[model samples]
Target: MTAPQQGSDAKSNDSSSFVTFSLAEETYAIDVLQVQEVLKVTEIAPVPGVPNYILGIINLRGDVVTVIDGRRRMGLPDQAPTDQSRIVIIDVDNQNVGILVDSVAEVVQIPSKSIDPAPAVGNDQSSRFILGVYSSSDGLTILISLEKLLSDEEWELVRNI
Candidate 1:
């Protein structure tokens, strides 16, 4: 999909608008339409028999939202956040979940010209989660394929619950 264009008022933009955030030293972004809200770091209840990367569930406004440790999912060593951690609440496959990010960054307008297709080389699993790379003044933002990121098996489990 091509990046969306914007008018004078930003709020009226299309679903392609993206909210960027930081994880470790790298930057990433997801379609703004996919993001429900951004929340502060909160307690998560552990779920047994689930993957370790799945950091359990969080209670958000009376709704149980699964929390995923993004760093762990990327094969990075875990480190406790020091006042900079944030939870980006996103809806994937009709399920609301919180992705633990290092910090929340600004929402940027990534034109179609700035986004490049995901590289076919390197780790296949990682590539599957990425949709494209958006170049910006700050740095490159890895645009995530939210639908694909939560694989079919995972979505089925969440849906069944």
Candidate 2:
């Protein structure tokens, strides 16, 4: 795995940066700092008795990284990935895992003024994984909270498997 490159303005407090990606038909973004790298989908070794959403584990430059299928985690039906599928490597609570996305969009700068709190009811589970919503010219992009998305329990299970 490649080490994270320190931004030139590392000392600056920036809340507008985000790395966007696609899942099914929806576009989402997460704090760019939370992202470790972007990789191609690779072969994974299955671990029996684990949740279906947990695809399996893959060797990432000598590091065994667990892979999570975002669609399945969100209660969506399983579907084959297209040419655009990507593995978004993220560091959650110091554990590295790769989340399978339909495709990666782009890195965007979302000003604080453009972000709004997630709705309370309609998107319960999805909202739990979200930090905020950013409205852009293209459309709405859900900003994900990586630490909350992959809490300790989730990582512990992956680590044990």
lDDT by residue for model 2 over 87-144, one digit each (tens)?
A: 9999877888889999998887776766899767435656678788888779889888
Cα RMSD (Å) between model 2 and the true structure? 6.1
Candidate 2: misplaced stretches above 4 Å? Answer: 1-14, 152-155
RMSD of 1: 5.0
lDDT of 1 by residue, 51-109 (tens): 77788888888888888888776665687865889989999778898888899987777
Q: Considering every candidate listed, which one attains the maximal lDDT?
A: 2
Over 4 Å off in model 1, which ranges?
A: 1-15, 158-161
Q: How many residue pairs clash in each candidate?
A: 0, 0
TM-score of structure candidate 2: 0.85
